[model samples]
Target: MYAATTIGGGLGTGLLSFYLGIGVAALLRTMFGYDAWDRDFNATIGYIFGLVGWLMGVGMWGTWGREWFGLKIKDPHANSRKELGWQRYFMFNVDHKVIGIQYLATFLVVFMTAGLMAMIIRLELMGSGQDFISNKTYNTVLGMHGIMMVAVAVAAVVGGLGNYAVPLMIGADDMAFPRMNALSYWLVPPVAVTLLLSPFLGGLETGWTAYPPLSVLTDSAQTFWNVAIITFGLSSILGGLNFVVTVMFMRAPGMTWGRLPMFVWSMFVTAWLALLYTQGFAVALIMVTLDRIAGMGFFDAERGGDPLLYQHVFWFYSHPAVYIMILPGFGIALEVIGHFSRKPLFAYRYAVGAFLGILGLSGVVWAHHMFTAGIPNYLHGPFLVATELISIPTGLIFLSALGTIWMGKLWLRTPMLFALAVIFNFACGGVTGIFLADVPTDIHLQDTYFVVAHFHYTIVGGEIFGLFAGIYYWFPKMTGKMYNEKLAKLHFWWMFIGFNLTFFIMHWPGIEGMNRRIADYPESLQTANLIVSLSAFLLGSSFIVFIYNFINSWVRGPAAEANPWGARTLEWQTSSPPPVENFLTPPVIAGHPYDYGVPGAAPHVTFFPPAVGSPAGGGGGGQ
Candidate 1:
């Protein structure tokens, strides 16, 4: 049954739908005299419909479509194979584990693709002139890289680790809406296609923000980018909704609010932030698309549209979007800290409070991004105060992390090292952000390499570092194999050193008056540009080590024990890769989710003894 809806089916159906849509649009234009629409308009609509077809052809209909029509159905047995085969990942399987791996694998490819584009950008800037690619091509590459990496930062952890670990940690067999979860994931591939396909439509150069007036007037490819962003946003919203429902209503029998793992709590809070704020960005993009396709005057300044209105709306979500990216990193870091340090989470309640505080403050602080754009002078002080105040909640995260590792059994594993690096990098990001928050400092640094360095430190250094930590920390459980520790450490040091060396020096050029988004720069900035570019190349190459370690370890490394880390989370209470149903039986919650350092602390959960000959009875269950 599942064979019909393979990856090939998805690609074929999507391509057929796209061509069919173009054909129908052409017919309408020629035969029916509907000549107002151009090829770009038709292409945009075609891509949207093609995405629908792709999802339908990817087997979403099997799990969700039949049930939607009230059809009584038997189990499709999609993931019935005891061994986790690679094919299940290619098709739509309702298993959370499969969905998680799908998200991770898909976005890692996107991340590396974007990283390659970054390499091109760095290479172009290396000689301080048009050495390689044309300036037009550079802008397009920069825009593409920005949007693609934003998609990765937004989806990789939440969609990947959040999907795989959240359910098991909460002792739920799966998410509350399994089909919705799968649908959210299936929505991403078409987005990737649209982003990559845009250059063919004449390319876009407005950068990831796509601020209109410029966006309203750019190449028709902007239409493709618009649709891609809207699609990705929709996927994010649905995924967030699933996390909220699952965490709220799906915990095990004795699991309670206070006892939830810090990571789960972060996910819960992050889901609400995603649910509430993502709509603003989505609506902003839709309005811009309408301006392009329907002549809607929402952002057209000549049409009496307010360009700044678009900025207001974009940053309304984008600023909070930063929090959305970093909050999970915070949770993952703290989770690693507690386990490796062999200590209870320091100031657990305060950390949770800080999360809540960050969420509350996020919505009001959007105007800080607009300080240099001539936002009301009267409003400047308030925005500055609001932006500066956010550090208090953010500071709690660092304090908790440092306090947890203070004088404890600090295990400097790959994950812990990455977690520690997150602190250093994020501190750099946070301090620089304070400068950007102040109107005076922002007037100096806005749109410079300083701005770029600041955000990369925050997002790449903070979120990506945490992402690596979570991946290494959970690799044992996810793959049921121990990664090569030497290679892993080498990957860590190479990336960490390379990342800092690249971005850290970028501040000097920014302070010395180097503007971003331009391919060429002054002769005086040449030496700095050369160094940064070379450092970036080395930073980019470190992932080669990571990719090798991930794949090699998965295929040939030693088998992992279920409770290799001896953490007390519910996920660790199950098998290394976990059973198809997650546990031998529904687990009975035993105590707090993180109870390290407390004498005689109980295990977080205990599974019922499996019936005779069950997989759990065969020793796949946790210790």
Candidate 2:
């Protein structure tokens, strides 16, 4: 059944690509003569051909099923797990845990590669002017850094950890569509590889923003980047769909909507944002490709194409993209807080409300990213109000965090430490974001390092910290081993300090008018630049502790119990590194996931042992 769906989807995507390609070609030929065989036209044709060829290959292998010419058909079941070896990782498996690990491993590889690009950018900025590479090379490197980091941030939580943990947390065997989950994850590598090799295709100089006019005139890197982006976007869309369906349809018996785990809620909201906005970016990129390859003039200013149109379409997705990145972190922080504090989530209803509010507000804030881009003055007020209103929902997140920690036992463990760091850094990021959202202030800070510092604080401080929290919180559950407490704490301190040292100082540079994306800076700012460069190196090296700790712990750490944190979530009820089918017998839900305490109640850990025929104590069983 899974194989058939996989083959059918692939074929459908392929056929759609073919018709779109031919249609585009026909339009070009009819508008221009055959003599107008331009670079754009050739690139478009090549892209379509590649898509068609890939689909045809999949069809031939799966539908035709011929191993050799005139050979007898082999039984599909002939080669079982014994024959597959490690090759199963390359194919779709129904196991959600396996898919999770796949996401984790792939994103780690991409993260490392992108991190190296950051190192190169820092090296060039180490001194007053460009030293290691030319300005063009430096710009390309920086562009790759931005684009790849965006990919990493977008995928790290949702694709990597979320894929692995959400189903388990919700007490489901797998995603509603396990095969589709596998497909989404598998799509990542090819896109990542393409982006990595973009430099060889002359490197895209428009930064990750890929703003037009400039993008249209750039080399093949644009083509490669566009296609790669489209592919990645498709992966996001599929993943989003799977998540939405799984959360809605696959919760264990008695797991009511209000009883859902915070992380699950976070994933649900993030998935909605992804579903809503991913297609916009996909469409915008597709149009850009049409303009570049077919001379369609969609964004070509001189040929009646409006350059501002690109900004509008791009941010329509990109702004929501930020929520997709941070909301998961909010979920992670809430999870960590509940466990470490031994408390129910503070203001649970408000936290959920905040998630929905952010989703609605995300679309309105895109123009905040475009304040200085020749937009009408009247337009700025509406976007600015909508942008500022987001802070109200975002403020609730802080209230939940601070309230949970106020009178509770704070562990200050590696995970908790990262959670604390997330609070501090995200606060700084969120506060600074207000300056950018205000049209008057944004005019001055728009392209400056202030924007850079603001996001790094939010993304790195918020998302990256949350990622570490998840890693530390769920490491045992995922791997059945404990990470080194001492080493984990050490890693946290170094990372926390190094991150601040690197990015905190950047705010001043932005305020002082240091333009972003440039390799060279003025002589007056040399000392600050040097400081940021050195701090960045230290920040980069901080990952060493994490690497050593993760590898050593996986092989040698003490065996982990099912419920390390003693929380009420269903995932903790199962064995560490859970069985292939997840719950050996179906799990029964108990009280709300965050029921840390209730008057006169014994502090007993809840478990739905197989013997208990009735649903666990809490809410009624699922309707």
Q: What TM-score would each prediction reach against the true structure?
A: 0.95, 0.88
Distance from true location, Cα of 216 in model 2, Å = 0.7
Q: By TM-score, how accurate is candidate 1?
A: 0.95
Off by over 4 Å in 1: 1-5, 23-33, 70-77, 609-623
Give me candidate 2's TM-score against the actual structure: 0.88
* lDDT (Cα, 0-100) at 500 in candidate 2: 98
Error of 1 at 518 (Å): 0.7
Give model 2 RMSD, 1 decimal. Answer: 5.7
lDDT of 1 by residue, 1-623 (tens): 34455677888888898887777777767786778458667887688768877887777666556766988543544554555466678777788988899999999999999999999999999997789998779889999999999988989999999999999999998898887888999899888988898887788779999998899888658888888899899999999999999999999988988888889988998999999999889989888888887779998767788999999999999999998899999889898888899988888899999999999999999988887888779989998999999999999998899899998899899999999999989999999998899889899899999999999999999999999999999999999999999999999999999999999999999999999899999999999999999999999999999999999999999999998888888899888999888887778788887688788988778876765664442311368
lDDT score of model 2?
0.81
- Best of the candidates, lDDT: 1
lDDT of 2 at 19: 57
